[model samples]
Target: MQKIPYTTINGGSVPMMILSVFSMITFTSVYGFDSVWTEWWWTYDGFSGPAWWGTKWPICTMGRYQSPIDILPDKLLFDPNLTGVVFSSEKKINGNLTNTGNDITLFVDDVIVPLINATSGPLQYVYHLHHIKLHFGHDEASGSEHTVNGQAFPAEIQLYMFNADLYANYTQAMSSPNGLVAVSIFLEVGKIGNEAYTMISNALTHIPTKGQQHRVHGLPLSVLLPQTKEYITYEGSLTQPQCQETVTWVIFNKPIYITEQQLTQLRNVNKEGGSHLLIFGNIRPSQPMYNRLVRTNINFRPKTKVCSMVKEVFYEVNTVQTRSGR
Candidate 1:
């Protein structure tokens, strides 16, 4: 059953997060990829989908550490060592967006003014953002791979990053220990949209089919992130094939917002040569946590009474500023 929206964890069986519901237009067809560059041509389903991925790469099925684990806020350990991660980059970044057949990724390797790097949280070495991957489902209830208390978000934004401090490139870092970080942000639909998300949403009109490319200039990477800084961290692997167990995952507690119309734009992208949408449900299913240590910096204390008292003293208007981080 779907839970109440905006439910926070104080204690007990209540969910950590449940996004506000809205009606979403449906796309029933499944598309293919034209620019899929993988040697094996692995997909999410059918002939050679996720089920067959382990046959080609043993680590996928054998590895103890895998990514996109469901996060339980109540069970998350409060680690004092976990702190706010700082993101540094040029005022704006330039990149070409591609429908990789897998997901829509923003490749910013070439046009970086200086560099886009994240440091000082769960990361021991600096990691560089190589690309941005967007994952979504056919509808609003189930897109994000990582779930909060078993509830999914509409979509997810992943910073496919590599440890630049220890490795030269993502290819080299993919297999090495402590080589990559999965910086994930949850995406939900709201009334007013985020400017950066709106820009990308509008640009989607140019690339409706697979293997299509569009250039996006002056993208502020910082604007895509949440300012709250509180997050959950764990050691895990890549979500796809050859699932290397060399990743440090930092999932923020706060979610970013995009307009319902903007999300529909993302839902409209196709894979390769079909009327169906590649983005209809491109997200990987959440893997088991096993005995993994899930840590967070967020204070899980009850806030119902505090919010009640504060609401009387200060009545703030419903504006974008209320959600400053997103």
Candidate 2:
């Protein structure tokens, strides 16, 4: 049976005490969110026909603002009104790292620990931290969900939040139009590794099989984000099934670095039930922009000053060489 929240007035069951302790100490699947595993294009079942999804899950084919769209640098509009996003979480938040069938998720225990809160970007309401998930591939070439100028990064990370002002729970928020916010950061392979991600990557060896969860403590949410706050904002749906169009996407312009060893650790997680099938490469193909305006917080000038100056010097030298030849 699903565990219920504890109350001080009614008490005394052994199971209740255990449940309360576990809930306060860790984050379990409170929402019970599920995605279709068999219907994906990359899966062994391999039934990727959009027609089938239209029949089974209409939202997959019908959503107007679908996620994982390529962000064309030339196409983005500069929104002077867009403000910088504010993100604050506890310095030492404890969590349980779970190898969910689809991806690896770090579930924060917010009841005992302070939950992360974000506000004031392109958002009208305050958003409370929900969870974080990782998406990666076999190599450093192509793993990210959203691409910039059709270029894919090695991996990507998504930090999710639910609108606290509008809804009391996650299910209700998923049903609303503006109920979720996702902060996406791209990951690149580098010489040095990220210490924040080491907490999760180190635990992947223990939870190789699906449905396996391990406890992790004192994880700082601040270290997981990119150093820069500059980002591109757009309206998009969840990349997974049920394809809810409730997310306001804030994809960071800057990417964080992870080492080759760290990437290998992420690629080692297996499919559920001891199948031993590594859950590597879970990026959904980019969706069409379809007349939607991708907005950025800052204005982008097309050319660099240094490049323009170099071009002028090169032109002058070329003319001199040509005149001498004549």
Q: Per-residue lDDT tens digits of candidate 1, residues 186-293? A: 887889877777777877888888788899988777788865787878899888777889989888767788988888888889887576746568867777767677
lDDT of 2 by residue, 245-312 (tens): 89999988677778988898888788777677877777777776667767776543442312111112
The all-Cα superposition gives candidate 1 an RMSD in Å to the true structure of 16.4
Q: Cα deviation in Å at residue 221, candidate 1?
A: 1.2
Clashing pairs in 2: none
TM per candidate comes to 0.79, 0.77
The TM-score between candidate 1 and the true structure equals: 0.79
Q: Pick by lDDT: which candidate is best?
A: 1
Evaluate residue 66 in candidate 2 and report its C-alpha lDDT on the 0 to 100 scale: 80
- The C-alpha RMSD of each candidate to the native structure, in angstroms, is 16.4, 13.1
lDDT of every predicted structure (CA atoms): 0.73, 0.71
Checking candidate 1 for backbone clashes, the offending pairs are: 32-271, 32-272, 138-280
